[model samples]
Target: MLRLFLRKYRTMILASVFFFYLGCCLTINFTRIECAFKTSSKNELETRVQSLSKAQYVVIILSSPNNEPKRDAIRATWGNFVNNIFVENGEIINKWNHTRISKQSQQNVVKLLFVVGTLGLSGTKADKLGNEQKRYKDFLILENVEDSYKNLSLKLLNALSWISENLKDMKYVIKCDDDSFVRIDLIVKDLDAFAPSMNAPKLNKFVTFKEHLPTYKGLYWGYFNGHAEVFLTGKWQEKGWFLCDNYLPYALGGGYVISRRIVDYIAQNMDFLSSYNAEDVSMGVWTASLNAINRVHDVRFDTEWKSRGCKDNMLIRHKQTTSDMFQMYKSLAQSNGEKLCNTEELHRKTYFYSWNVLPSSCCKRN
Candidate 1:
């Protein structure tokens, strides 16, 4: 009787093992199939979506559906004000066909877009976003990806893909968060001086002069310096392991401008590039992977919780609320809108810490 019981127990264990292996095989197959489906869906969407034509520079504001007030605030203040003008005829024409009123149109070369992602399969959130898009006709929606913090990298890729496909002619593409406020007058003045004509000279070529030198074609301008470590665990860790120990020298995600060349490179390599959930860091990785990209540092793009002292000189200020945007615009107006603000603190490096995982070397306070 003991021998019979032992044989029966062995048979049951064998059956369980067989079933578990089969389940694993099925799960693996299902995941592959799901990934394939998602890839196809994204490809289809990419093909069907239309691109915005014209515009020398495109300022893409990464926003959400619920942030209508913030969007409106931007439009009311800096959004509506184009190139230091306050609007005489209430109509300024640029390449993107954005029919809005602002100050005098110096070059009328900048275009604004708010990018948002889908909420779910079918719900009020999705509906609200659709309605908002239709009403404004300014948002670029990511149908394949969900709108969540973890999926920001994918959202950024979607934007890059669209821009590459559609806005290829635009000289520079500035990726900004909804909360970040840009002094358009400053940006336009810089772009104009750097790349004034179609054959504008390319700046920032030498190794020693990258810090204060102006850049033109093939330039990746932002507030970033050396590499930061990729955390394998905790809040900062998601898919960071795909990258090496340190993230590549890329711009901060809050606000950075990528030249047409980088955008083209990103568009071409989107399929094979590993997706790290952190958009800014992932962008650094992407640029680092490519050999031809010219990564130039400009401290004018501020991404700090507490900004530096050069308020007037800031080209872009992150972590702004609607109220904050209004106040900044007012300040800009008072400071003689067109005169380039002092870059006294422009070269000063600012440090930001969201988690304690980052090393002292990641961001050096100077």
Candidate 2:
């Protein structure tokens, strides 16, 4: 009887082993089938790329309301700057004001894409345009809010959604405030030289910020005065102000670039927060959470004309008066203080000579 039982047990074990091997074989086959599907999909993508035009186009979305003279003025300012300095002249850079969506002239564009918001749409032209534009599945609008933080947050979320839907075909997306002025020529040249490797996976290149706060419980609040607003709820006691710790890094506002992938990720994950004020900081935290590297490029991110103290030489300047903008552009055109305006040119020359370009080693004391 004992011998018969041992033989039966061995037979059962063999059957179990045979079935496990069969299951493993089936799984391996299915994996290969899935991989083949992916390869075919990749080939399809390659075919599409081969057929499409390969031109680098910069898309600038300037948010403004309708019939505002400022919108036209901003357009003029951008048009003049882009025409004079940028490499891809006429039709290469498409600048669209958010206010003119409803006009008969704008119907074609609104059909393609549209964004709506208070700052984005002002009068009848804008309202009609926005209403019509919203019919499209891709159209996005700013979140309605009475405060600056919520308003800007909604604006950014809308922009991110638009970018994700469009980035596959776009070369670059530049998001700037209405008040910000760009040196398009310099920007194009810089991007041309620094465009991340086409061979490697897409890289996330943008200005990153680091912030550090103290360990003290109550003493740690109320440090950030650069831009801070009150919260609607008292969930947390209103301490002094929260300071971006001296050691902690955080991205600065006024706007920054995001790679297509990063934009896609943000669009899918941006949650509605009640009290977060700094959009740039929020973006930095989000990107870092995804393990994406946030590159801190040395290009001057933001500057005011009046505060041009010693660092007048900057690639980009923000919050400049109209008169100051004229002066700065005129200075660049005239070669006054050659160092300030011609840094990009100088770097190009130095690069051509095969000499090492030194990193900019300067910091503004807050």
Candidate 3:
């Protein structure tokens, strides 16, 4: 009878005993659930991400004022998944009330926001964008930064700054292009699998990596370009990139992932960071100098200069036209998400980055 009673409350008894030992051994004790959450596995950072600390990930789309059609296409399609927003007849009826994201919603809550620049936006265009922001409440407009290809890096820095100042609770930030089609479900699943390994220490880029290498604490996942040549004078000319013979190896700008610490670092030090011509290149330079960083060169990210065609488990595909987005979304919906894309429709050769090779020879014909 005693054994049966003990067995019935085994977990609670064990927990109480374990915490009692902790209280004796440590200076602080679990007086309340808050302290327990701090010292126990109940409030592990990964646990928070898996359940609800705040939003685990926020997809920040770099957009232009003129890309309303592309934005609408995304909102109505892949970006409109159950995990994302819900818009009705071009207006955000916000089916999910804009309250503090509840613990239930945080399990897979991947929010979406567009980053636009207000350099030349005026009168009708500005008014239209204002109306759109009012309707959707999903835009981060960098008023000082110009919405141009040349200012993309600046745009990115400002966006990170905004995230740090405002939505700082998110664990991961996905910097995606407006044209890219994001696979949110696949990404969330992959991220959960990737979360247990996140145990790195404070991430600061200004602290030069000279002494012992800091054990990697965070993640930077994307398709990285190991070698990219510079243009001294051209449409892509960068007057500020004199750091090395080639630009620092950077993940392609179409879509990439960085942890919150990285975002915080950039946001905190953005005023002093240099803005190169390419936002991705700036990202490389910024993170390359960080205390410690672990990068996953995910081939699943077809975010190179162009798509590596359509693969089975792609996380995000860049250079997608508005039409392409609709078609792909339609196929996924019809197949109940079992079929990602029509293999017959997008027939391009697949390739991988040769990380084993030298930086200059990383990309090869395969």
Candidate 4:
């Protein structure tokens, strides 16, 4: 009887060990499945955006939730500068609340959206952002991700994905940082005029790269140039992806406009592309991968101000202080071209020096 009891106990131990190993195997498999599901969900986000139909143009601004002052300055200034005057309660208001661009006669309608990600483990940021969104109705919040400097590329991917899904009908999509001042007035006007050129059978020779004839289809516009060893460095390094050589010709990241076709391409191919911590370099890599993409240079869209002075043709300025934004907005409101240009010129001289220059053959500001 004793021997029989010992054998039963041994059998029970074996069964317990077997089940433990089985549980471990199942847990590992479940983890992988969860990761794959997250990836697929991210990929499917574009499909969702595509289903929402497209718009004429979308100015996607990258902002963090904590940066309320910057966002407010933008909306109060350049955001509502174009065709945004309307009468509300017997008073003329320039705020987006009363100003309607959707019903305007112009085909180059521009919609503004601030894209942001959530803070980790804290719901306060999301709540604040939600309230802000309700008040402004212009934010595109990425709920699944955390907001961090390291996530700029991911944030961009989210922006492109969302734009492709919701605003795909837009002729052009402008991606700018919150600190950027986009001359929306000029941009809308120029895009309206340039629409016909985009639809033409052949593209205007706006920008040419390495003897490659320019085409209008995959137009990526910004202040572009050749830079040697311009890839991310230090903490922003891309790990396995080393750029021992010069960076391929690409736009500066502070702000740029891309056609709907390129947005669509990026939206579809996002899952397959490798991401770098530096959002701009990652953009360069993705565009470089596609033959159809063109790195067009236009001085007006100064992603990094290098001009000795701001001329009348200045369109976009980056890295402005909050005070500068307000001051610039006041100048814009006054339509004081001379003052604005002088201020911009002063800013250019103060912030940047001409270390390198692009060839004169590159595209001129339109």
lDDT of each: 0.66, 0.41, 0.73, 0.66
How many clashes does the backbone of model 4 have?
7
TM-score to true structure, per model: 0.68, 0.48, 0.73, 0.69
Q: What's the distance in Å from true for residue 312, model 3?
A: 2.5
Clashing pairs in 3: 200-217
Residue 263 in candidate 2 has what lDDT?
64
* lDDT of model number 3: 0.73
Which segments of candidate 1 are over 4 A away from where they belong? 1-51, 83-108, 119-122, 195-217, 338-364
Please give the RMSD to the true structure for each candidate, in Å. Answer: 13.6, 20.4, 21.1, 10.4
The TM-score between candidate 4 and the true structure equals: 0.69
Clash number for each model: 4, 16, 1, 7
lDDT of 1 by residue, 186-304 (tens): 56556656532212334332111122324334666677745566667876686646545676666777788777888888888889888777788878777765543455455567865
Q: Total backbone clashes of model 2?
A: 16
Q: Which residue window of length 10 is worst by lDDT in model 3?
A: 202-211
Which of the two, 2 or 4, has more TM-score?
4
Deviation of model 2 at 278, angstroms: 3.1
Q: What is the lDDT of residue 134 in candidate 1?
A: 56
Which lDDT value does model 2 have at 181?
51
Over all chains combined, what TM-score does candidate 3 have? 0.73
How far residue 92's Cα lies from its native spot in candidate 4, in Å, is 23
Candidate 4: tens digits of C-alpha lDDT, residues 1-366: 988887879988889999999999999999999999889757765554543343466888888878999999998877865455333453333333323334433332457888888747277766787678758767778877688878898999988887776664677788889888788656655565554233322333332333234454577767664553544567656565665455555577788888888888888988987777767777877887666554555556657634334555667888777887778767755663324443434444222212134433232332
Better model by TM-score: candidate 1 vs candidate 4: 4
